[model samples]
Target: MIWIIIEFLFPALLIALPLTLYKSNRPLMTKFYLRMTASGSARKLYARCMLILILLYHYVYAGGHFGEWGILASTTFCAILFSFRRADRWLTRLHEERKIFFLTAVLVLTTCAVPHLHTVAVTLAFLLLAAMFYPSRNVLSKWTDEENRIRWMNNPKIVSEYYY
Candidate 1:
């Protein structure tokens, strides 16, 4: 009975938590989108293509054999690679701070993929979900700084010339 409930709940939470976080972080995501757009069209197109490829690989090729853990690891690996190449200094800094979180998430997801570690995985996932809502002070400060920068960029005088 409890096992059955947990089996259902774990997958549901895995899907729901990320979606909730994405929705809640819309403003920040929007700012990221704007910054990406401002970077250049070629890079934007490359990013979109890479995203499509990764999704296709995950769903069509890797999903049945390796499950969600494969995607988590691959995505984290990609992010670590991309962080160094990002055009924005602030984004690079943010990614640097998140490297530890990304590593831990990968570790947890890998553990979750193991056959006999279900309980531990569930606990880690819950803890990680909680942590997502309450980021470290450095991350919070950086986010605040980015918001202020965006606000400054949107000033009447600056918006006319720079902002799209």
Candidate 2:
């Protein structure tokens, strides 16, 4: 029970950090996250801590063919991916690209929450999701110029909800 509470509370606390510290702007949140993790060592430390915490949780709660190894592998792969500039660009894009990445990441997390899915399926989904971000860096760099910014700002639908 304590572990479960910690598991829930830890993420909530982390989420609350940026929300409380920043305005309700999506771009600000992205920038805040990037700044917080600007250091490669800091990022690695965070990933290592997450890996330890998650593995401990899985070992205690998920018994018998629950695919703990697959989960670990996916986490490891994601940590490795985070080391690349491409991953950072994909994650921190200041435009619609970031929204797409955010949506895809949320979807992946949602799907990964299904306890009934085989571990292998979950692992494959995670890998595919990670791979999906690979091409966006180049594409977004090309699209993030001032002309595109002007076009994006001119959109009526986007102007009202300008935070995202």
Candidate 3:
């Protein structure tokens, strides 16, 4: 009984550590977020790589079946296609928020789908989920303001040299 309880609570405890840290240290997290978002292309590349890794994990460890391979291939192809698109220029705040929400949902679903949940698997899933959802309400507001300022400063009609 004790082992079962520990198995279930371990991941939750691991996830809580980061949440508490972020909650207690707002400025530090904001700075981290700014540094992360400074290079837009780098952010996209990191996200794509993480997604591919997650899919690969699902394919390899979860089950090496034909169905899993097909799902992995199709999802990877779609991810590649989306990455190549020039849609980043047109993304609004609302669109970005929706994408974040979608990613969170996907992560949750993927974690829940593991056939045999083990300690390591649960730990990895929770860590990934926590990292993905790190931005708190205060940090997000600051991020939005920073993004808007950058967009305003970088407007083609404003000037040639960048302000920020």
Model 1: how far is 60 from its true place, Å?
33
- What TM-score would each prediction reach against the true structure? 0.37, 0.40, 0.37
lDDT of 3: 0.43
* Better-scoring candidate (TM-score), 2 or 3: 2
Write down the lDDT of every candidate, Cα atoms only: 0.46, 0.43, 0.43
The residue pairs that clash in candidate 1, if any, are none
lDDT for each residue of candidate 1 in 71-148, tens digit (9 for 90 to 100): 565555445434424423323333345685577678778877885454345444543443343223343344346664
Among these predictions, the greatest TM-score belongs to: 2
Runs in model 2 lying further than 4 Å from the true structure: 24-70, 82-84, 94-99, 116-164
Largest lDDT belongs to which candidate? 1
Q: What is the lDDT of candidate 2?
A: 0.43
Tens digit of per-residue lDDT, candidate 2, span 58-102: 444354345454556444654564454544444345233656656
List the pairs of residues colliding in candidate 3.
Answer: none
lDDT of 3 by residue, 77-130 (tens): 335535523323222222336575466446556755764333234434543443
Candidate order by TM-score, decreasing, is: 2, 3, 1
